[model samples]
Target: MQKNGFPLDELDFAILSCLQKDGRMSFTVIAEKLNVSIGTIRTRVNKLIEEGTINIIGRVNPAKVGFGAYAQIAIYVRPATLKDKVAQKIARLPEVSFLAMTSGDYDLEVDVMCRDNDHLVQFINEISKIEGVYQTKTTLYFKVYKYAQPDLNLLK
Candidate 1:
């Protein structure tokens, strides 16, 4: 990678593509799949980590963890302040599983994990009370039949 974040090379992109799909895959496994030495895989993985090209993390299902009700809250900010600040507040809220800035009528979208509909309503009420928030729309999840799986070829 270049100092100013140059586009990744084939090797770097390939490594990222693999890890993005399965963060917990062993270095040896990756090396074999990519037809490279384990040492090379280890070194490249370390570089990717340092360069922020990849993040290896443990992901858990909120529903399986006793938070079955999920809500997607679309927030309309009065003037749209720094998302980082709002995200910090959302992160501190245990029920907030995911949050992101968007490019539409809503300034931010928050994924919340709730125990029930009451929990979801209470959380939305609390979020609406945050400073600078004008309005919010919530979408409740019914049945999520599928989970996200990254396609490595997109990066290629």
Candidate 2:
């Protein structure tokens, strides 16, 4: 892992990988798997959390949780200087699962999950009302085959 420029060492990667698989996995189990002391695991985990390198949280399936409408929206922002301001407004929307500024025809891209098509429509209307929003193209996702976190092994 030292070969890479990333600050994380092999042990850190190993610990993150284990937690990625199961956030609730015990430090003792990780210690046993990685052949490290429980205290070492605890200390490393605490450091990781403090540094904001990792977040331990329960992930739920949006569909299973009553979010039936999933969609991606590409937004065109006028007066590009207000891009950051617009992004801040969109980010505050509870229905938005992901949002990013992009270099393309669209100034911003956002993913949202809603309870139904009506809810999606309402959400879109809400976004359109924000300042600097010129136009938006939304695509509905009927079925999502894969939704997950990045694979840590790839960083190795």
By lDDT, who's the top model here?
2
Over 1-156, each residue of candidate 1 has an lDDT whose tens digit, in order, gives: 453465567777777777777878899988898899999999988887887767788877777878768878888887666555666777689888778888989888998889998888889888777777788899999877766656657643
Q: After TM-score superposition, what is the CA distance of residue 123 in candidate 2 from its true location, in Å?
A: 0.6
Task: Please list the C-alpha lDDT of all candidates, in the order they appear.
Answer: 0.80, 0.94
- The residue pairs that clash in candidate 1, if any, are none
Give TM-scores for every candidate, taking all chains together and pairing residue i with residue i: 0.82, 0.95
Name the runs in model 2 displaced over 4 angstroms: 1-6
Q: What is the lDDT of residue 150 in candidate 1?
A: 64
Candidate 2 lDDT, 114-136, residue by residue in tens: 99999999999998999999999
Q: lDDT score of model 2?
A: 0.94
Per-candidate alpha-carbon RMSD to the true structure: 2.7, 1.9
Off by over 4 Å in 1: 1-7, 81-88
Poorest stretch of ten by lDDT in candidate 2 = 1-10
